[model samples]
Structure formats: structure tokens, C-alpha cells
Target: MRSATSKARFPILLLTLLVSISAAAGEKLTALQLFQAKRYAEAQIAYEQLAAADPGNAETHFHLGLLALRRNATDTAIAELERAVALDGKNSDYFAQLGSAYGAAAQAAGLFSKAGLARKCRVALEKAVELDPDNLDAREGLVAFYRQAPAFVGGGIEKAYAEAEEIKNRDVLAGSLLLAQLATGEKKYDAAFATLDRVLADHPDAYLALYAYGRIAAESGLRLDVGERHLRRCLELPPPARAPAHAAVQWRLGLIAEKRPDLPAARAAYAAALELDPAFSPARDALARLPKP
Candidate 1:
């Protein structure tokens, strides 16, 4: 009788173990799905629970970091991403995101702390690239940093160009866009337009190219009508992952409308931008600055 009872308990215990393992995996999937769906608040809670349950889980911390970053909680993002990197130093993505968080923190830091934070940001990004040379996001971050940072802080337009060339070698569209952006920054409007025109000719419906073209138009205040038309066309396209959000395109529309001196249209465009993303400070600020209706 005792032997029979022991055999019954062994099967029950094994089943319980399998169920627990399945539940843990399901939790991870559910949390990831929530994050991908942009249900960030819920995803944060779910990740926090997972972190609590499995404190060693680097993935959990990484997701939590990304969610915090989305909300502009840079401090929390840095902390969580740091944990992720500490747990998995070999992961290029973890280091890349940690670098981004560090960059954001540097931007918000006061003058005294800014340099140190920026250096950390650069180091992490460089490490990420070293770990995986094919990481476009990491390479893009390096390009942006090199383009924007002063020479003293390891920024150079030449370096930016080199990185853009590297990207172009891997992905023509992204590289062309980055190079065009670099040209735009230097007020080389013709060169910028020429590059973008080539992209548009090849991929007429590419939303990113359209948006980039519209952005240059808005920035230079040239070709307003064409820019507006292209931007409106961007709104009609399906937003793909990693592309500029609709809020950004709407903001550009507002800028173009303002350039046209169409006050009402500008106001409407800004309001539409805010409606899509209330946290979009540029749109919010622009809307607030308009004369009270």
C-alpha cells in the first residue's frame, strides 16, 4: 500500500513541475507580446513580476528597461538595462539599448555630469558594434552620435560619413537616408534632395523616404507644396516597425502649414499630432504656443 501511494505522488509531482515550467514560459511570452503591442504599462507590470520571480533573467530586465525608456523614465531605464548587460555581457542588443539609455540620460544631465554620461554612452555603443558589426541600430546610434557630438567628445562629420558608408554597404536605403540627413545638416540641400530623389524613384511608396524628403523640405522651408503632398502620402502608408511614427509626420505637416502662414491649418495639424501621441513634447509645446481659440 505504501509503495502504491508513493508511485501516485511521484507522477503528480512530475506533472506539477511540468506545469510550472510551462507557466513560466507562457508568462515570458505574454509579457513580450504586451510589450510588442505597445501595451507598455501592463508589460511593465508583467516584466516586474517576472524579474521578481527570476531575478537572474536578463531578458526581463531588458524589456523593463525598454518600457521605461519609452516613458522617458531614463533613470529606471538605465538601472534596468545595466542589470541586463551585467547579466548578459555578450548580447549586442542589451549593450546597444544600454547605450541609448545612457545617451538619453546624458541629454537630460546638467553640464557637469553630461560629459561623463556621454562617454559611457559612446563606450557602450562602440562595444555593441564590436560585438556585432551587423547591428544596424547600434551603427545608426554611432552615426548620430558622431554627427552631433563636438570633436572634443569624439564627434566628427567624417566619422559620421564613414559610418553612413558602412550602412550603405549593408542597406542602401538606410545608408542613403543617413547620408542625405548628413547633407541636410550641412545645408547641402541640393545634395540631400538628389539622394532622396534617387530613393523615391526606386521605392516610390517607401514611407521612410517620403518622410525624409518631407523632413528636408520642412527644415529648409523649400518646396513646401511638394513636401506637404509627400507628407500626406506618408500618412496613407502603413506604419512599419522602426519607422517614424505618425505623430512625427503630423508635426512636419504643422511645420509646413506654419511656413505657409496658414495659422488655422497649423493649429489643426499640431492638435492632430498631440492626439496621436500626447507625450510628444514638440507637438504639445507647439499647440500650447498658438493663440487661444
Candidate 2:
């Protein structure tokens, strides 16, 4: 009788252990499935439950952080993501998410806020790259963060240019366009023109680049003839049928005409832009400022 009782108790203990392991695994699987499905709210709840049950589960905390981010709960996301990174110090993804959370918080704090928040975001993103240099998403996020930040706070034409160059191997045209934008921002008219020329040389029919070149030429006041030619070429490109390139080209033409004080031509171009895009505020504003003929 004693032996049989002991045997029964041993089986009960084994069964309890198995059940606990199964429950934990099941919760984790459910959390992953919900996350993959983009059911962020549900995933958050599931992850929170799992986190409570297994307080040391870094993956659970990471998922919760990501879910909070999806819901735009920036503060909560930051806390959870920071905790996730703390628990799993080697994960680049965790650090990248934390950086994104900091960036969102800084953006919410308004443009005039202190540089500390932006710097924190920058550091976090940099650390993410240090941990995983091939993280494309982190690289892109860093690029965007630096681009939007003020020049006084570690953001400038040089930084933008470097970031663009870093990604040029993957997308030459995009990198060249970005470089041109940085050059234009810095008032480096010659450099901007050169960058645009390189892009156009490789892809002659790139309507977007042509349009950008036209604007850069018109604004820089260095090469009106070249600017006008680019603008006209942009207009001559075959339409993509669903894009607003036509409206954009008309707007650019109006801008050139306005610069030349050709009121009649400016008015015509603005009218064409508005015809294509009724909600184009710039064209409407330009039309309002024009002298009545």
C-alpha cells in the first residue's frame, strides 16, 4: 500500500511539471501568432499575461513593447522596449524599437524641445547598428530621424549626405537624389547640380529627379536655361496614369514663372496645377497673389 501511494504521487508531480511547461509554451505561441497577425491589442494583452507568468521572458516584453508602439502608446512602448533591451542586451531589433520610441516621444515634445531626447534616440539607433550593421530598417530610421532633427542638434547637410552615401549601394538613384537635396539645403548649387546630373545620366527618364532638378535650378538662380529644360523634360515624360506627376510639374512651372515675374505664364501654370489637383494649396495661394489681368 505504501509503495503504491508513492508511485501515484510521483506520477502526479511529473504530470504537474508537464502541464506547467505546456501552458507556458502555449502562451508564448499565442503571443507570437497574435503579433504576426497584427492584432496588436490582443497581442499586448497576451504578452502581458505571459510576461507576468514568466517575468524573465525578454521576448514577451519585446512583443509587448512592439504592440504598444503599434498602438502609439509611446511612453509605455519606451518603457517595455527599454526593459526588453536590458534583459536581452544583444538584440539589435530591441534597441532599434527603443530608438524609434524615443524619436516619437521627441517629436511629440514639439520642435523647440531640448536636444537631449533627440540625442538619446540617435545614440540608441547607433547602438542598434553597432550591434547589427546589416539592419536596414534601423539604418532607414536613423536616416529619417537625423533628417527631421534641427541642424543645431546633430542634424545637418553633412549628416544627411553621409547617410545617403551609406545607402547608395542599394539604391543609387535614391541616394543621389537625397545627396542633391542635402546639397541644395547647404546652398551648394554646383554640388547639387552635379549630383542630379549623375542621377539623370544613369536614369534619363526619371521624372521625379528631373522635376527636382528643375526646382533646384530655378531656386539656385545659377542656371535658368538648364532649369527650364529639366522642367520641360519632366513634363514630356509619359504619365504613370495614376500618379500626380502632372500636377507637380505644373506647380514647378508656376514657381519658375513666378520667379521670372511672368504673371500671365505663372497664372496659367497655377491654373493647370489646380485643375489637376483641386486641393493643391500652393497653386491656390499663388493664384490669390497674382495681379488681375
Candidate 3:
């Protein structure tokens, strides 16, 4: 009897193991994972498949919309995001991304369509902020809108400053960076410089801050020597962060060196950038333009 019972349990265990393996095989990754990995093409394909299988899935539509936006397919993005909103109107992130899509679409639209699209962008962004005040990205989007749009529309520089203050409460460095951007946009270079200096003084090894400072200083010709140092420091940052920006840093340093009359250094920098990103057009252009040493 005991031998018979043991034999019976063997089949049940096998069945359980097979079920687990099958479930594992069938598991689907969340769309956000693909999006965060910057695999927009793959994510779009996955989302398209998902939306076809589950026609009422708002998240699938929303992710498709995001992928379309990334690819600058404004019309498709609008259609997908509208469907997402219809299915899940309360999703603040969907509205925020939709707002961004509309904003981009407005840039190239005809005069007749431009005004209407801008209005839609403003309204969607506002709704996103209202729905989730804690969402830093949404707030930043609204701030950008406010800073860029004319006073005739639903945007004001004062409103942007107020939002900047709110951001400061959460992230001091981010707020300062925004403030610098605002000043730069307004052509208040001195003010922007002060803000960048403050950030670097506090966080000397801040990779992003250093990169921004270098780019600005180099482009503006404010302090080419100092800018070179900052760019070098940015390159020194270890791995992960450094790898993604390697080509960019090298290109910017090339530009600075070319303008500073250091032709050899400029050529070397451009060559380095090209070695990393073979198709980097800016570096190629700069390298071609340089006089041979």
C-alpha cells in the first residue's frame, strides 16, 4: 500500500513541476521594462501584440503611444494616447506624455492647427500636474511650457519660477539646473554661470553638472581652459554614466578645442568621439573641417 501511495505522489509532483515551467515560459514582461531600457522599437512591437490580444488594455495603448512619441510619429502617438485616455482617463503619466506629444506636433503644424494643438498641450499638461502634484516630470513639463509659451496663452515666466521653487523643495540641484536653463533661455548668461558655479562648488564630481558647465562655457567662449578641465573630469567618471556620454563629451571637447585654436587637440578629440560612435555626424563634420596638423 505504501509503495502504491509513493508511486501516486510521483505523478502529482511531475504535474506540478510541468505547470510551473509552463507558467514561467508564458510570463510576459511589463511594457515599462522595455521602455525604460530604451528599446522603443521592441517595446512598440510588444505593445502592438498586447493591444491586439487585449483590445481594452489601457497600459498597452499608453506604452505604444510613448514609443510612437519617441520615434516622433506624432499622429500615431496622438491616436494611441487618446485611446489610452479613453480607457484610463485618470493615468497622469499618460496625460503628461500625451501633452509632450502634442507640444512637439505643434512645432511643425500650420498656423491654423498650431494654436489649437498648443491649447491641447497646455490643458493636458495641466491636468497631469493636477492629477499627480508629486510627479516631478509632469511639473517640469509644465514649467517648460510656462517658460516657453507667450503670456497670451496659459503660460507665464512667473509661473515657471514658482514651479522651480517647488522643485527646489524636493531636489535642490535639479531646481538650480532648471533655474540655470531658464536664465540661459532668457540670455542671462551671467546668472546662468553663477548657478552652474554654485552646483559645481557643492558637488565637484557631479558628472551631469560638469558636462553642462563645460558645454556652456565652451560654446559661449567664457573660459575655454576651465571648460576643458570640466570636460576631462566628466570623462573620468567611472563606467555606466561615463560610457553613455563618452561620445558626447569627446565631441564637445573637440568643438571647444577647435574654437580655441588647438587644432591638434580638436582633431584628437573628434577622432576619439568617432571611434566610439562611428556615425557621429558632428564629430565627422568637425574632423573634416579641421586643418591637418
Give, for candidate 3, the lowest lDDT window spanning 10 residues: 23-32
Q: Best-fitting candidate, measured by lDDT?
A: 1
> Comparing candidate 1 with candidate 3, which one achieves the higher TM-score?
3
> What would the per-residue lDDT of candidate 3 be over residues 199-252, giving only the tens digit for each residue?
889888877777777777767777777788988998888534334467888998
**Which portions of model 2 miss their true places by more than 4 Å?**
1-73, 80-94, 110-113, 131-137, 140-157, 235-245
In angstroms, the error of model 2 at 202 is 1.2
The Cα error of candidate 1 at residue 206, in Å, is 2.5
Backbone clashes, each candidate: 0, 0, 0
Please list the C-alpha lDDT of all candidates, in the order they appear: 0.92, 0.82, 0.83
TM-score of each: 0.78, 0.66, 0.80
Query: Can you write out model 2's per-residue Cα lDDT over 1-293, one digit (the tens) per residue?
Result: 56988988998999999999998898899889988998877887888889888888888888888888888898899889889998999999999989998888898886556477788888889899899877766777777877778776677555666777876666776677777877788798899999888888989887767877888876766676677788888778876554447777788787788787688988999999899889988888988988899
Ordering by TM-score: 3, 1, 2
Question: Per-residue CA lDDT of candidate 1, range 1-293, in tens?
Answer: 56988998998999999999999999999999999998888998999999999999999999999999999999999999999999999999999999999999989999988888888888999999999999999999999989977787788999999999899899989999999999999999989988888888889888988999899888889988988888999999987798989999999999998887887998999999989998999988888887877
| TM-score for predicted model 2 compared with the true structure | 0.66
Comparing 2 and 3 on lDDT, the stronger one: 3
Candidate 3 — which pairs collide?
Answer: none
67, model 3: CA deviation in Å?
2.9
Clashes of 1: 0
CA shift at 262, candidate 2, in angstroms? 2.1
